[model samples]
Target chain A: MSAPIQLRPDETFILNVGPQHPATHGVLRVKMEMDGEYIVKAETVLGYVHRMHEKMGENRTYAQYLPNLSRLDYLGALGYTHGHVLSIERAAGIEVPERAEYIRAITVELNRVASHLFWFGAFVMDLGGFSPLMYAIQDREHILDILEGVTGSRLTYCYYRFGGLYNDVDDEFIEATKRFIPNMRKSLKKYAALVTGNIIFHKRLEGIAPVSAETCRKYGATGPVARGSGINFDVRKNEPYSVYSDFDFDVPVYQEGDSLARYKVRMDEIEQSLRIIEQGLAKLPAGPIMTEKKPKNIKLPVGDFYQAVETARGSFGIRIVSDGDKNAYRLKLRSPTYSNMHLFDETCEGMLIMDALAFMGSLDLVIPEMDR
Target chain B: MGGYFSDIFYGGKSLLVGLSITFREFFKPTVTVQYPYQTIKMSARFRGHIELLADDTGSPKCVACGMCQRACPSSCISLDSVSVDIEVDGKVKKKKVLSRYDLNFTTCSLCGQCVENCNFGAIDFSKEYNLASTRKEDFHFDLLDRLKRLEEKKA
Candidate 1:
């Protein structure tokens, strides 16, 4: 549909891309000023799925707010849960067991792989390749199976507690994770052969929508999007939390800053996740999963506390303001996709509508995460 | 002419390589589990919904502590209990007996907060996941009656 706007006397039109369009990944509407197929300017309208999670945090106790973390990013729910738990633990001075830290690392990395797999499928599907989505989901189901074995739910897992996990993972979970790493490696090789080397896919993506490192810094785009622009800033390595410093892995970075570069960064991150999972499995200690002296009732000191963790998309930050009460005085969630999506207004200018959609896919937005 | 033909040859080779990968996977077993007709078994830890756990004496282990009701984020669980006089160790003692236990599955997040805070191990998640119903009333369940029926069936 065309909206009558007085941009020029020539053939200039306005188009609305979503709020309901399947290509949007969620309920996100992008208004574009288009001359034929090119986007002159683009603006994103948000708050479609906002459920006031921050207000809910102020109403409920810290423990009760655990389930809301999963609702933020269903694809990588554990990372948000981990962030919330770590922030509260730091504020309350709770010590987590070493084994529980290792378990958290392993499960979070497994969730990262699953998130990237879903993105891989959806990104290709956005590019009009249908077969890769089915293949990617098939691989992702294995990760879900391993996670469901211990976390009790596959997606939107409310598994982690303040000091440790709710339940200790069984030997079968370890065995399943050990089996998954090599299987995932074999699948990565297959994906390289199938999708990466295709000329048509490369032609559409390579050297298109190059975001400079400065733009990333301005927008606070941290994950693979920033990494694609050769910004080697990952929260895990920079501000090492949990047992992340124990694992030896590489953060993949590409200098091209194109859609393909971002795509390659995520593809390579999958391999690094597999490496982290393998190392975590080997280093998993035999001990209590939870700390012995956890507080029955959680009340933080009268101060502001913040925790940031690297999720599948980018850095996920949680800020809690407490007056030493059962409920939070104020809670703020800084989601990665929200920051990453902001760059669209600056980046989509002078690009074709098709390439703009591809660029959106490359950013890997989970709309609920952004809206929340 | 030579450069154009060479480009075509390179493209064809890459296309063939891509096709070969797909062709190899085409012969492999399909990954789909064909749901409903051929259901895959859920894992042991699959969280479906909250259910009251029955004790060895064929009654709910819940002491009517009201802890789960208070701890629930959505206010989905409600229990009605009355104090009754019972003989314990040759003495008259007043005990709280559960009259009604209502769990609104429609609003429940299955976050296991109720199960975790129960302390008495009186509640756990049931593995009944195929919960499609035509009527909205089917979701609101009376757990005390369900627990009694379960205990009777066990006996």
Candidate 2:
């Protein structure tokens, strides 16, 4: 496409890593200029899975756009939905009930753990560990069942309404969630022993494809990628959205900034997420789930409102500009993966193909979300 | 030589630990439900394709307000209503009754907007999940006919 950008001498051959490769995860294509095994220049080609989510938001009413947020990141659907719902709530000035906020926090944290488990499995699989994927997916199914009990639909959950949750969690859901926490902690221990402590995993990742904190900042790489590079900037702690401020959880930061460091950050985040879920369950107040006052028709008061939340990947920001209409004048979804994926171009320069691929996995690229 | 030997020892030990973890889990019963022979119970809040609800007298409950038709983002739902004379307390009165409620299931996002927007509890999600079909036109659900079919099956 466009004559390969006129490669200069000494760049060697060009290696393309799929607009449709398993290792690339989703429909992401990386154009890597290679000299035998070492990559000279890497350019990530996107927009393969772009469904124009922002454009779709403009075409539909604010309430109807709820389902579209989940499609952005299926692995962390609730977090995106939570961010969108918060922005809509802010725009319409709808007050969310205390119980609703607690439920939102609990579900969002659950989703974060699920996303990390999937990443852990897939990342390990990328490094030639097959059994961990089985172990990880098996554990992940439990979390899905627990979520599906309350939210319905396993992947693209459209459970959150404009004001609060679409429906209240049943007693069985709460009990199962409480039971799942300790079990997941046990699973984490197994994962640590299975993958984290394994020599092969360390050998493949540690000190390989090192991304400096400066590089992360340059690319605006938030979430585990930034946290891996010793950046203490989680939107949960830094910005403090929803009921995240109420929970006492530490942001795990590693200075190594390698693939292993990002791995450790995500693993530690699962523990922190578990801690948040437990606290949320314990302090869940008994009150109205939805706000008593019905929200008025969504008409933004001729201003732009931005709401940001800590998704599993990073901080997902939603910007809504309404020209006093039921539909948004302009809706911009600031996907975290887009910024994270941009790091691949600069970071993967002059690295081995395998190590760069490993580094890409560590970034946890959801191609659809990036393209969105 | 000492560092090399120790590195070998620790790496071997971690590998053994990983093996042991898998070994213990191997004895556990499989989590996968045997499909074709078994099916998981659908949740109450499970959002499936929208279906029409029936009143106690085996009549369609839809008042045909057209809120769901308007509220749907994809515009997958198409409602057709007809006004007919009905005997009411020794008097003839014209009443709006649902003729057809068609859902283009391929375009349906299962968003629950139709169910939420409806003032009367005349529509709900049918727990028909394992919807595998070859033809695209097969998904075009006529809820009125589906309701009568369900009623006959129940009887």
Candidate 3:
């Protein structure tokens, strides 16, 4: 070396955002390298909330392992459970009844709507708006009441069995759901007028951390993240698992991949989900809720099986490898938040700290799900 | 300058729209329920802690099958059975009677696996939501003893 190079003081500094910060939502830390108010690099430090769910899955029987999927994403727990149940059902070659399929489709769509509504409240709260959360939860209570009346729990509903639902939804459940659809529509209208056109929301989100379609594909961001960037891909539409193919609905796509684009995508998704629920309720057939002669023990065939479902966050996939034993040989959970959070490392670079936080919130991260 | 004024106008319009909704809702009845003094009723299917159901003769209906113990993900349940003498056709016969049923409530996830596994309908969910205690021992419950005491009190 010719000489020691002198570096200027205060040129850059490392900011520990949190394994404890409120903006992080959970035990997630961002070791961000900062130059003044802007981020030079942001590396997400996960595993603070890791429970090694995959290892747990391999050791336990399918019945024992079913509830673990719901804990991964409590805001939209049913979708992850659905993926796992679907995979195990495919492996075992169990024939889920048409009535069960229709009920599952309706409940899953209702769950998606509940998830997006909660996210809207939480996302706004992250940006310092509190009233929206109150309003959102107030509306979401109707859904919880309806589901709880049938499933017996609010969040983390382990409602679906391997072949069908645990029990049937009563006529009261149908009446409540039918009454809720129009009321939720009115709430959505109010939300649009209140927050969508607000100048403060516009300034905070519009054109901030613009993620292009290429970036989304490179990072494997699905659901609203990809749809926000004009990628016309949705697991429900493209793959058409369950009775989704029977319903006619539009997958909303926004050309702009900014935070606002993601926001608009989720809002529009709520509408589509509502439409699916409407159709499902109308076509709710009469039959047995469960298949006769249910197997006492579940032993999947010696092979790998997978199923993917569109959760509120993104596409959640569950893959299982069975050795023809009661327990799975290997279980892999492909959580959407894990891939979605990785986009932060590249996309959040050079963004203002505030904007970075807003962008992080827009991703709708569930840190435990990502870590698990 | 024109664009700035139009933006402000639209922003104000949106603000008024939000304010109007809030203003009209001020007259509506409050939704918050007061805890302790006022309580919401639990749904018919509300899942809580596992409870041992009683038979017509005021004894536990459990036959000590151990299906629940095997099916529990957390291994939170343990039970013991004893041979009891009974008269059948005026002759002494041996039958298994449930002697102990312990529940490790600390590890219980309230998944309702025990209820589903029971073919005899010996268990159900008890609507015990106000569970709070300091000592760990309070959580480890002897279901057989509790059932006996409950039956005695009812009698």
Candidate 4:
């Protein structure tokens, strides 16, 4: 047997960064090992907000569970609502009207833009910059105003249906969005001026949380985080759905494996998303937004179906296992934040504690979605 | 030593540029809205809460059509309609009366599906969404609350 080696005292300090810390973003607890201020190891502990949404899905009918989808990403409720509704429509193989698809596309894109704006604000705030949060929120408020006009609620909007929309978009809404595009474009420039090229922001974010392409591919980091690291995978482009095929837009990519690269990628995508919205508005087809095909008692066929959509955080996928009943047998939400955040333990290693918090911010985690 | 100087020079330049922006914004119009005192007006279009309404006759406009109950995806609403015998002009007439109307607001998605499906336009969403209570029982809304108030007025 080899002789026992002596270890020095105070080589590493165990730090509990809490299930309630502001940087952890939710009830997420990360136990970190630190050598002074530098984090040497991190382990994430989840399930603080887990309400067993999957188990609840099994008990509730397909239609009955529709409302629960918005609760997952409660901060950006529309993204969750859109992903679930789109999945149900795909699974049932129902034909939605052209007008319905157009409306759905419009609302979703608006929601995407709103969600990204919020993330942009929050990300900068995490980096100790405050002005951009208020500025970005100002633009985000306009998008909410447009959605509220038709959907009748601000956040956690349950305005989508399986083969159609809950209501029709009014003429005022059309005019409002038309005016909003220019205003939003102008605001983006201001956001760039405020934080994009700032020295402190660049220093804090550049070359930090370096998630390589191989790592992103291995872990399936979708949305901006993967795109920032030179991954050319976008569910909208790869698996085209709704009226997205009809619209013309580019998928923005950044080859830099850093938080700054992720920031730039999200900002560029926001511009591209605005262009998609513009095209959607211009060629929005006129017809009934709801299908005449309302199935009795919310029953669906028994089968396993997978549907993925681009959310603000990443690629949001819903996998439903149905047993030919009014409700689902099993519903699993592949939340983007959940996958994106798993990298936190690996990336936070050998970084300052504050830098780890900044990295968490860059990932743009929504805790309920992660817990769910 | 040369690289250190170059980095310092670039860092100083970057700081100056950022400061210029700060100085410019300082002179610009302040956009902050004092939320409570000087309120930013929320539009009428803002959909906040779901409310049950009554018609001018103080009777619920919901005709027990069950359209709302059917359209609800969450099944948070449980409705029961009963037929009542009424004597009008010495003839017995059957009228539909709402026996039980239960809405679990906690489970409701605020999707406005029930409101949109109502052909009779009986229900609407109120702008009041500050709905928080200590007990789960407090979330349940009874539409007949207004009807009972009218009955009290008649008395």
Question: Residue pairs in steric clash, candidate 2?
Answer: none
lDDT by residue (A260-343, candidate 3, tens digit) is 999999999999999999999999999987778675689988888889898888888988888999999989989998999989
Interface RMSD of each: 1.0, 1.0, 1.1, 2.6
Which regions of candidate 3 deviate over 4 angstroms?
Answer: A1-10
Show model 2 residue runs off by greater than 4 Å. A1-11
On lDDT, the candidate that comes out on top is: 1
- Candidate 1's residue-wise lDDT over A233-347, tens digit each? 8999999999999999999999999999999999999999999999999989999988997667798999999999999999999999999899999999999999999999999
Better of 2 and 4 by TM-score: 2
TM-score of chain B of each: 0.90, 0.94, 0.95, 0.75
Tell me the DockQ of each model, to 2 decimals: 0.78, 0.79, 0.74, 0.51
**Model 4 residue A347 distance off true place after TM-score fit, in angstroms:** 2.1
Model 1: residues with Cα > 4 Å off, grouped in runs: A1-9, B1-7
TM-score of 4: 0.90
Each model's TM-score, in the order given?
0.97, 0.97, 0.97, 0.90
On the 0 to 100 scale, the lDDT of residue B83 in model 4 is: 96
Give candidate 3's fnat, 2 decimals.
0.65
Query: For residues B105-149, what per-residue lDDT tens digits would candidate 3 score against the true structure?
Result: 998877777888899999988888888999989999898888998
Evaluate model 2: give its TM-score: 0.97
For A1-372, candidate 2 gives per-residue lDDT tens digits of 567676566659888999899999999999988998999999999889989999999999888898888999989999999999999888778899999999999999999999999999999989888999998898899899988888778999999887777899989989999889989999988888889889989899989978899998998999999999999899999988788889999999999999999999999999999999999999999998888875635666778999999999998999999888888999999999999999999888989999999999999999889898
